[model samples]
Target: MPKPLYQCRVLVTATSYGVHDPALKTTLESQVGEVVYNQSGRPFTAEELAALIPGFDACIAGLDRFDRQVIARADHLRVIARYGTGVDNIDLDAAREKGIIITNTPAANADSVAELTVGLILALARNIVVADRETRAGLWPRLQGISVNGKTVGLIGFGAIGRRVAQKLSGLGCQILAFDPYTDPASGEGLAHFTSREEVIASADFLSLHCPLTGQTRGMVDAAFLKSMKRGAFLINTARGELIDEAALIAALNEGHLRGAALDVFTRQPPGADHPLLAMPQVIVTPHMGAHSDHAANAMGWGALNNCLAVLRGEEPENRVV
Candidate 1:
């Protein structure tokens, strides 16, 4: 027989797991014997996880490292339910070998992330951040900005979040170009023009990245890639940070090859104040908060909570990755 719910111990490492909805924690606590929260207020390291995994029946994970060594130490772990969509931090091969089910709440934060992507694009085109700061400092200069009404916007990936971004921008009267090898070209028929990667890069006035981080895509935005972009075109990235080579981006900005960049993610989380990117006036940065909206946070919490409970109850979980 399966173990009683009251005897199961669950570890929650995602800092935002229940912050938007407290009932999620109440529900999990009612069903489990013990619920341990990560008090660190950040993702735990592999060393910390390896030390903590032995007694947990499951974990609602975040951006924490889950390597082979950490998986091997999860003696009582039956599931690793990711609180958000990405599972790039986990070692899937190790989890599969250890018979630990892996799951994620896919598309839970797509709308929120898409909205943020559009917002960043606008912010960059208009010099909004600089304008706001200047006004606050008692300067009254009229800042020049471009309108998206007649611009060509290019999207690198056409997944759920990317599609939502295109849909949101549809009414703006801008020409939308998208490049995604994995998606059906017919899907973007009315909303966007499916095109070659080379064409999108060469023609767009605003280029936005919505792609996933993979070996092939990592550092795809090197110096050559930036140099090839339309001069003075804006770049927006709401996706992974490692996708762009930071040094190349810095050089591109220094040489005025590109107009500006707005980033929601970085090569390192909470980049140091002295970081060159942080010092650039043409660069805008956010604290990786694209998925922090109440709507998205609540959805992700419930999705992860349900996935964790389902696996523990001997039922098949949704969005199972391994």
Candidate 2:
């Protein structure tokens, strides 16, 4: 006998789920018997998820730590609908073994993230943060800044977000060089010049990362990689945090090997008040807010909601990842 759709129980962990639009929540509640929201205000740890997952049929997930043990404890969980595109936080192998379907909303937040990446680039080039701080402190200091026009901008990955970024910067007259082994050259068209990783790294005036985090890319930006970069060039990461070695970055910035860095994600969430990166005025950091735009929020919410409902109703989801 099939479980009744109205008797299905769903768990939602994303903090901003349905925040921009109430219709997402209303639609989800109408389809499922019960919807439990995460009250923790942050991603739940594996232990916390292990305690709460046993009875749920589906989950609209955030960046929660969905490790092997957590998946093993999800006795009835059939699907996990990620609110954002990245699935690095979820343990795919364990989910596959457990026959738990995973779906993510691709391109849902691409524009939002790309916009922030450009903003960070501009902010870093112009030292906007320092200027704002000094001005608000009742000191008017004339600052020298570089122009983005004709600058050689490098992109580490040329996926959806990267492509969007390239398109946005085209009018700025930047020489966009991108490296992504998996992307087809035709896909980029006139947006970016696809090139070797080494060339992109060495030639860029401002290097931005848009790659997904994986075993191959973890800590790829180490001391050696950072040392090879063009002296005094800036680094920007709107991708995953673990991609760069934080200690190496700190050392590079300390010794003036790199001019500055702008980070939207970190190796650790809320990298604390006393974190070394926060103390550097040259570095700009945000609380992983690259995809928090209202438009992005609504799209992610609706996509995740639809995914959860589709799987629960025994239908195929549009964005099945595993």
**Which candidate should be chosen as best, given lDDT against the real structure?**
2
lDDT of 1 by residue, 213-308 (tens): 888999999988998899998889988999999999999899998999999999988788899999898999999999989999999999999999
TM-score of each: 0.97, 0.98
lDDT of 2 by residue, 16-79 (tens): 9988898988888988899999998999998999999999999999899899999999999999
lDDT of each: 0.93, 0.94
* Root-mean-square deviation per candidate: 1.1, 0.9
Compared with the true structure, the alpha-carbon lDDT of candidate 1 equals 0.93
lDDT score of model 2?
0.94
- lDDT score, candidate 2, position 76: 92
Which residue ranges in model 2 land beyond 4 Å of their true spot?
none
Compared with the true structure, model 1 gives a TM-score of: 0.97
